[model samples]
Target: MTEKLWVFDTTLRDGEQVPGCQLDTREKIIVAQALEALGVDVLEAGFPVSSPGDFKSVQEISKAVSNPTICALSRAVEKDIEVAADSLRFAKKGRIHTGIGVSGYHIQHKLRSTPEAVLERAVKAVTFAKNLVDEVEFYAEDAGRADKDYLAKIIEAVIKAGAKVVNIPDTTGYCLPVQYGALIRFLKENVSNIDQAIIATHCHNDLGLATANTLSGVENGARQVEVTMNGIGERAGNTSLEEVVMAIKCHSEIPVHTDIVTKKIYETSRIISKLMNMPIQPNKAIVGKNAFAHSSGIHQDGVLKFRENYEIIDPKDVGVEESSIVLTARSGRAALKHHLNLLGFPVEGEKLNEIYERFLELADTKRDIGRKELLSLIGEQMDHSLLVEIQDISYQGAEGKEANAEVTLEMGDKVLTGSSKGNGPVDAVIKSIKQLIEHKVILDEFLIQAMTKGSDDVCKVHMRIMHEGKPYYGFASETDIVLASARAFVDALNKLPIKATN
Candidate 1:
C-alpha cells in the first residue's frame, strides 16, 4: 500500500535563520499563505521564544492560513511552550513542537546534563506540550550523534508521553544515509509504543547529505520530512523541501507521496526567495532556473527534439511554463530575465527596459551568454546607447489559417519597420524581425505556451536561431503569443552581426 508522507515545512522558522534574510510578521503571512496553497502538512511558523517578532509572525500566520497545521517551535521549557501555545490562539489546528537534545555529546557538552536527566526532560516536554495542544511534536535534537540505545529509550518515552510526531534529526548533518537509515530502523525496533507517533526526519546539509539522509530515513520507516524552502537554514542549510518532494515523486517505487501540489513548487520557491532575500543557487535542484535550461548545442538539439531526452521533471510541473534554451553566442532580454530570476537578480519596470537594452549590447560582445557573462555584464556600468528597442507590433493568426506579423524597431537612433507572412504566428514574427534588421538568420525552433489558466493568461515564448554557424536563444512573455513571438524575434536579431549562419 502507498503511504502518505507528511511534508513538515520549517521555512518560516529555520529558513528565516539565514543571515540578513529575516522576514517580519507580514512577510511571514505571505509565505504561510503560499505554503498553505502548496499543501504542506505542517507549517512550522516560528520559534516563539526566539524573538517577539517571530512570536507575532506565528500568531499572524495562524490567523492567515486555515489549512495546514500551524506549528510553533519551543524548547522543552515551560516559557517556550507557553509562548508557543499563545501564539497559535487563532489557528484552526495547532501543534506545539517541543524537544531537547538526546545525544550524549549534547547532554554532556551542550546541556551539561546526564542521559537520565535528559530522558526525563524529553518526557516532561512532550507531556507539557500535549497538554497545551492536541497535536504535539517532539524533536530529539542531534539524534545522529546520540547512542542508538539511549536514543531509542528517550524516543519511546516521548511517544508514551503523548508525542504525535517524533523528530529524529541529523542536527549537524554528520551521518551517512546508510547510518541514518539504520538508526531509524533501530528506533522503530526498540521503541515499544512507536506505532503511537510518526517518525520524522530532520536532516541538515553540512555534508551535502541532508536530502540523502532524509530519504534514507523515510525509506527506513519515517513517514514525515522536515524541510525548508530553497534549503535555507543554518550553515549549509536544512534539507531542501523541493529535493525531497521531487525524490518521492520521481521514485514513486518508494511507495510514498506528499499532498503537496507539485505545480506550486516553483511559485512558492520564488515567493520565499523574494521575501527572505535569499537567492537560490542556480544549480539547486527542482526550482533552480538551470534545472530545466538546455545550454550546450548537443543538449539543445536533443531537448528540442524530445524534452525527455534530458529533463526528468517537466518545468511546467513546477509552475515554470517551459524549459529554457541558453544561447550559444548570445541571448535576448527574455532569456536574460529568465536566467536572472533563476540566478537571483530580478529587475522590473523601467529598470527592466533599461537593463534589457544593455543586455542586448552585452550579447554582442559575448558568444555564450550564460550566468557568468550575464552577471559580469550587469556588474559593469557600461554604455547601452547602441542597443535596439522594439515597438509598434501586431500579429494575426487563428486555429486553421496562416499567420502574419508587423513590427517597428529603433536601432542606433534609427527607426526601421518590416512585415512578413508565415505558416504560423511565431514564424511570421521571426520573419518580420529578420526583414526589419536585414539579417540572414533561420528560426531553428520556437516554443509557445500559456503560463496560467485564463482568457487573458500570460503567454511565454522561447526561440532559437542559427546565425553564422552559431546558435542564439531569445524569449518573451506577453498577453499575446504573436506579440511575445515578435519580441523574441527582435531579441534574437539584436544578437546578430547583420549576417546568416556561416
Candidate 2:
C-alpha cells in the first residue's frame, strides 16, 4: 500500500504574511473554500489570537468550509488555545496547532525560560489542546537549530501529552536538507513516544530550500508536509504546494500520495494572486507564465518534432492549455514560420525572408511584436489595409486635495476640449474623457500598479470594460498614475460601439 502524505496548507496563516498580501475576512473565506475544493487535507486558517480580524477570518473560514479540517495557530498559552477552540467551533474537523520556541537562543532570549521549563510548557500546551480537540498538533519552533537531545525530549513530551501530530519546523530556514532529514531521523530514533503521533515537516524558504527540506523529511519518515500555495509567506516563503506535489508525483522512487486535485492548482493560484493584488512571477514554477513556455530555436525545433524531448511534463497535465512558442530576435526560420503559420499565414523562402526582415525591423523598434502587428506588416505588401483609423487621445490630471483635469481630442478636422471635477484627479480625468467621448460603458475592473521600484516609478493601468455582456481589456502606462488610469479607461471605452444599444 502506498503511504499517504497529508498536505497541510498554511496559505491563510503563513502565506498571508507576505508583504502587501493581506486578505480581508471575506477574501480569506473565499480562499478557504477554494482550498477545500482543491482537496487540501488541512487548512491552517489563521492565528486566532493575533488580532480580531484574524480571529474573525478563522471563525468565518471554519464556518464556510466542511470538507477539509480547519486549523488555527496559537502559542502555547491557555488563552491562545481557548481563542483557537472558539474560532474553530463550527468546523467539521478542527485542529489546534500550538507551539513554543525550543531552541537554546529562543529559550534564553525570546521565551526567557530554561530548557526544562520550555519542555514542561510544551507538554502542558499540547495536553490543554488535547482536552479541547481530539486533533492537536504541536510545533517545536526553530527545531532546526535546537540540540538533538532537547528536541527529542520536547517531541516525546508532546506526544505523551496526546498530540496527534508533531511538527518539526525549520523556523529560520537555516538547515540543509541532509541535516534537516538527519534531525527528523534522530527524533524518530530517540523520542520514546514518537510512534504515538505523526511527524510533520514545516520548512521555510529563507535559503530557498523549504521544499527540499520537506521532501528530505518525508524520506526520513515524516508523514505530513506543511506548505503554502505559490510559496507565499513571511520573509522568503514557505514550502510551495505545487512544487512538492508535482515532485512526489513525478518521483517514482519516493512515491507519495496526496488528496489535492492537481488540476485545480492553477485556478486557485490565479484566484489568490488576483485577490491579493499580487502578480505571480512569470518564471515561478508550475503555475508561472514561463513554466511551459519554449523560446529557443533548438528547443522549439525539438518540441515541434517531439514534445517529450524537451518537456518532461505535459502542459495539459497541469491544466495549462499549451506551450507558447514565442518569436524573438533570436528566433530561427523554423520558429518564425511556426508563429506565422499560427497566425494563418504560411509562407516560405523569399516570402518568409521578406516577412522575417520586416519582423526584425519591428522587433528592433518594439520590445515585443504582436501577431496583429505582424499581420498588418504582411498585409501592407498585398495591398490590404488592416489598420483601424481610430485616433488615440491622451489626457493628464493635476495633483492636490481638489485637482482638475484637461482633455484633448482629435478627429478629422475637429478638436474637442473638456474639463471636469470629481473625488480624485483620476476620477476627474475619467469624467472629463467620458464627457468628450460621450461613450457609455461599464467599468468592470480598474487597477494601477507601479511598473518599477522607486518613489517616482512609472504607473501602468489595466482596465476592463463590459458592454452588452462582452468584456474588453485595455492597458496604458505613464509617469503619472492618475493620467495612466484615465487613458486606459478611455482606451477601453473606445473599443465599444459608438452608437448606444440596450
Candidate 3:
C-alpha cells in the first residue's frame, strides 16, 4: 500500500525570501490559488509577524484558497505564534508552523542559549500554538547538524506537547544523503513518541544534493517533504517540488504518493518564475526549457524512433505539447528529417543525404535551424502566403519625444503597413510589426551578436517568439541592427501555426 506523502510548499514563505521576489497581498493570493489547484497538501503562506504586508498577504491567501491546509510561519516566541494563528482566521484548514534552533552550533552561537532551555521553549511553543489551531507543526532548525540524541529528545518533547508534525531541516544543506537518511532513522528508532507525529524533510540545496537527501529521508521514514517551486529560496535554494514529486512518480517502489497534479508542473513552474522575476535555467530538471528538448544526433534519432528510448516521462505528462527535436550541428539525419517533415518538406534517401551535408555546414554557423533556413537549404521556392518580407522600415528618435516607427511588409502578393511609438527604435519596430500580424506573440528572448569589432560590422539577431505557450526561433543578419531585429521577428512569425493567422 502506498502511504500518502504530504507536500508542504513554502514558496510564499521560504521562496519569496529570495531578495526582490516578494509579492504583494493580491499577488500572494493568486499564487495561493494556483498552488491549491496544483494539489499541494500544505501551503506555507508567509511569516505573518515579519511585516504588515506579509500579515495581510497571509490573511488574504487563507481566504483565497480553501483546498490546501493554509500554513503560516513563526518563531517559537509568543507574539509570532499569535500573529501566525490570527492570519489563518479565514482558512478552512489552518496550521501554525513554529520552530527554533536546535543544533549545538545554533544553540551556542545563533540562539545564545543552552540545549535544556531550547528544549523547554520548543515544548512551550507547540503547547501555545496547539491551543490556537487544530494543526500545529514544530521545526527543529538545523536538525541536520544537531546531536542525534538531543535531537531525538526535542522531537519527542514537541510531539508530546501537541506538535502534530515535526520538521527536520537541513538548514545549511550540510548533510550527505546517507547521513540525512540515518538521522531520520535514528529519530524513528530512538524517539519513543515519534509515531505520534509525522516527520517532515526540509532539505536545502547548498551542495546540490537536496533532492537526493529528501528521497533518502522519504525512503527511511519521513512522510512529508517541504519544497519550493523551481527550487527558489535563499542562497542555493530549497528542494524542488516538481523534482521530488516526479522522482517518486517515476520510481513507484518509494511506497509514498503525493497529491501533486503532475501534468500541471511545467505551467506552474513558469508562473512562479514569471511572477517572481526568476528565470529558470535552461538545464534545470523537470521544468526547465531543455527538459523535453533533444538536440544531439544520437539522442534525436533514438527519440524519433521511440520516445521512451531517451525520455522517461512523456512530454505531455508535464503539459508540454510535444518534445522538441532541435536541429543543430550535432543533430543527425533523423533529426533533420523530423524538422523537414514538420516544415512540410519531406525528403528521403539521396535527397536526405544531400541535405544532411549542407545542414551540418549551416548548423555550424546557426545554433538552431528554423523554417527559413530549412527552405533555403532545400532550395525550395518561398511560400509567399506564409513568408513575411520586410519591405521598408523607418524610425525617428528625439531627446524628449518618444521614438516612433513605420514599417511596410509584403507576404506573397498581399502588402500590409503598420506604425507605432515606443521607447526605442527596436521597440517601436517590433510593436509596429505586432499590429501587422494576427498572431498573439510575446518576444521571449532577443539576442544580438556583432560579427566584427567595428561600427560598420554587420550584426546578427536571434529572436524567440512564444505563441500559445510554444516557442519558435528565428535568425537574421544585416548592417542595420534594427532592420535585422525586424527581420528576425518576421522569420519567427512565419513559423507560427497557420491558424494563428486566422
Predicted model with the maximum lDDT: 3
lDDT of 1 at 279: 66
* Residues 118-222, model 3: lDDT tens digits: 999999999999999999999999999999999999999999999999999999999999999999999999999999999999999999999999999999999
**Superposed model 1: Cα runs more than 4 Å off:** 329-365, 368-502
Q: Which candidate is the best by TM-score?
A: 3
Candidate 2 lDDT tens digits, 1-502: 5799999999998999888899999999889998999899999999999999999998888889889889999999999999999998988999999999999889999999999899999989999998998799999999999999988988988898899999999999999999999999998899988988999999999999999999999999999999998999889999999999888888878857888888888778877887786767768899876687776778888888899988887776666666766666766667778766755677889988888788777776664444455566677332112212234433344453566766766643566777877666877776766676544566655677888988889988877665654444567899878767766775665444232111
Ordered from best to worst lDDT, the candidate numbers read 3, 1, 2
- Location of the lowest summed lDDT over 10 successive residues in candidate 1: 493-502
Each candidate's TM vs. the true structure? 0.71, 0.82, 0.88
Candidate 1, residues 133-182: lDDT per residue as tens digits?
88999999999999999888888888888999999999999999999999
Measured by TM-score, how close is model 3 to the native structure? 0.88
Clashes of each: 5, 0, 0
- 10 residues in a row with least lDDT, candidate 3: 493-502
